[model samples]
Every structure is written in C-alpha cells, then in structure tokens.
Target: MIRGVRGATTINQNTEKEIIQRTEELLLKMIDANAIVAEDVAQVLISVTNDITACFPAKALRNLDGWDYVPVMCTKEIAVPDSLPSCIRVMMTVNTEVAQKDVNHIYLYAAQSLRPDLSKS
Candidate 1:
C-alpha cells in the first residue's frame, strides 16, 4: 500500500546552507523514524514558506546516497497571515507494509507549533 509520511522544520535563515541543512535533517529524521528506504519512496512533495526563496528544499536530497532517482516536486507554501516563517514542509509517498496510523510525522523547531496535536507527548 502507499502511505504518506509528513515532516516540517523551520530554518534559521533563508540562505541555501541553512535551508539545505534543515531540510536534510527533517528528511533524515522522517526516514529513520519510519525506516524508509529510497526504493520505498514513490515521490516527495515539498513546500516552503514564501519568505524562503534561497533554494529548493528538495535539492538537499541530491547529495544523499540512493536519492538521485527519487521523484521530488517543490513549491511555495500558501502564504497565510501569522503562519510560521522559514518553514519547510514535506510529504513523501512511500510503498510500505506499515499501516497508515503507524507512520511517523515529524515537526521540528518552530514548525512544531504548526501541528501541536501531532507533537510527541
């Protein structure tokens, strides 16, 4: 079955380095939490707040082993008033045996506030 794993993180700045580092961290965390391998991933959808125009968050995966062939789509997150700034969000579609309810969704840094209900207790 195809399942979705979501994650979001806040970058300290809009610079390429910060975006890449934070995005990579978020992806790694999701992968580790869900035991997701590249072969299991169908596609990755990423969205960033309008304020972050420095680089595409998906580009951070380019240097990761086994991620070169994975399909990734990046876009600007809808600009909402009072929304968290420098937030990068991702939704990865993966073919996995795990039940949907068992999947891990990670939210870190300021982005954690975006989904307080999903936060780890």
Candidate 2:
C-alpha cells in the first residue's frame, strides 16, 4: 500500500545552514521512526513558511545517500495568520507494507504545537 508519513520542524533562523540542518534533522527522525528506506519512498513534498526563503528543504535531502534517485519538491506554505514561523513541513509518500495506522509521524521543536494530537511529545 502507498502510505504517507508526515513531519514538521522549526528553525531558529532563515539562513541556508539553519534551514538545511533543521530539515535534515526532521527527515532523519521521520525516516528512522518509520523504518523508511530510499527504495520505498515514492516522493517527498516539503513546504516552508513564507518567512523562510533562504533555501529549499529538498536541497538537504540531496546530500543523503541514495536520496538522489528519490523525487523531492519544495514549496512555500500558505501564509496564515498566527501560524508557526520558520516552519518546514514534509509529507512523504512511500510504498510500504506497514498499515496506515502503524505509520509514525514526527513533529519537532516549536512545530510540535502545530500537531499536538499526533505528536509523540
């Protein structure tokens, strides 16, 4: 079945290094928590808050081994009033034997506030 894993994190700043680092941290946690392998990933969709324009989160994934073949895209999130700032979110589509209910989603840092119901915190 094609399952989806969701994750989100916040960066302290909008710099390229901060964005990339935070994105990498979020992706690694999501991938590890869900046992996601490169071959199983169909695509990754990343969205960042409008305030974060320094770099694309997808660029960070390119540095991962075997991620070069995976399709990744990034876009700006819809600007909503009172929304979390400097946030990066990801929805990864993957072919997995795991049931939908078994999938583990990750939310880190201040982004945890965005999904209190699903968060492990």
Candidate 3:
C-alpha cells in the first residue's frame, strides 16, 4: 500500500536561511510523525508559494539528512488570489501499510489555517 503525507511550513522572512530552516524543520516533523524511513519513501515533491523563490525547500531537507539517495523535485506554487505567502508545502508519497487515518499530516504556521480540522485546532 502507499499513502501520501501532506505538510506545510512558513517563513517569517524571505531570506535563504529562513527558507531552508523552516522547510527542514517541517519536513523533519512530517517524516518523524509518519514514521517515514528512506526505504518507505517513493518520492518527494515540494512547492513554494509564489511569494517564495529564495530557495528550493526540498534541497534543504536533502542537505539536512545528507540524503544522497532520495529523489526530490520542486516547483512554484500556483498563484491564486488571497493565497498565503512565504509558504512551503510538501507531498510525500510513501510505501506503507498504515491506514490513511493513521497517517500524520502536518500543517504549520499560517498554512495550519488551511487544514484546521486535521490539525485539531
């Protein structure tokens, strides 16, 4: 079986360091929460909202984990009206036996507002 874990994070500033740190922090949480090991991950795709182009958030994770083995891709989020700015989002597809309800989905900072129900806010 395969499941997708969704997560998001925000940066207070548009600097490269802020982008990298916030992205790394959120991804680490997402991976830990869902018990996602390297072997289980099929692929990771990251998108940063239009306001963000300081860096590719996925690279931050790769650098943090020393992940020379994982495949990662990044793209710019679609520019929609009234969208949250400075946001980094990840969709990780993993091979897992866990049920969808048992999987953890992370939403942090302003992005949390989008999935308040899931976050139990």
Candidate 4:
C-alpha cells in the first residue's frame, strides 16, 4: 500500500547546526516510527519556513541515512505572520503494510510549538 508519513520539527536558532541537527533527528524518527526502510520509501518532500536558507533539510537526511536513490525535494512554506520560523517539515510517501492511523508523525524542538494539538492526536 502506498501511504504518506508526515513529520516536522524546527530549529530554535537561525544557525546551520541547529537546522541540521533538528532535521536529521526528525527524519530518523519519522522513518523509525513507521518502520520504513529506505527501500520502501518512494519520495520525500521537505517544506521549510522562509526564515531558513543556509542548508536544506533533505541534504541532512541523505548524509545521515545514505539514501541516495530515494528522491527528496525541498520547498519554501507560505510565509505567515507570527508563525514558527526556522521550521522544517516533511511529507514522505512509502509503500508500507501499515495503516494510516498506525503512522506516528514526529514533532520536535521549536516545531513542537507549531502543532501541539496534532502531536497529541
């Protein structure tokens, strides 16, 4: 079955280290939570808020996971007022036997503040 597994998190600061750290952590959790092996993943799309630019979150995933064949794209999220800055979000499509409800999306760092309600769900 093809399904989407979502995960998101944010950097508390506007530095490169914070961006890479948070993104790598979130991606790992998302994959682990759904028991998604790299071979099972179809594609990954990363959406980040406007405040961040130095590094792409997808690069962090590649360096960490060694998934060179899995396609990953990055885009800028719509800029909104009073929203979380330095936030990186991911939507992953995978071929999995797991149900949609069985998927556990991860939220960490400042991104936790963006969607506390979703996390609780």
- lDDT string for model 2 (1-121, tens) is 9999999999997899999999999999998999899999999999999899998889889989989999999988999998998899999999999998899999999999988988996
Candidate 3 minimal-lDDT segment of 10 residues: 59-68
The per-model lDDT (C-alpha) reads 0.91, 0.93, 0.85, 0.82
Error of 2 at 66 (Å): 0.8
Q: Which residue window of length 10 is worst by lDDT in model 2?
A: 55-64
TM-score of each: 0.96, 0.97, 0.93, 0.89
List, residue by residue over 47-68, the lDDT tens digit for candidate 4. 9999888787777877755588
lDDT of 2: 0.93
In order of lDDT, best first, we have: 2, 1, 3, 4
Clashes of each: 0, 0, 0, 0
Give the top-scoring candidate (TM-score): 2
| Model 2 clashing residue pairs (backbone) | none
Q: Which 10 successive residues of model 1 have the least lDDT summed?
A: 112-121
lDDT of 1 at 31: 93
Better of 1 and 4 by lDDT: 1
In angstroms, the error of model 1 at 84 is: 1.2
| Candidate 1 wrong stretches, greater than 4 Å | none
Tens-place lDDT digits, model 1, residues 59-89: 8888689999999999988888988888999
RMSD values, in order shown: 1.1, 0.8, 1.4, 1.8
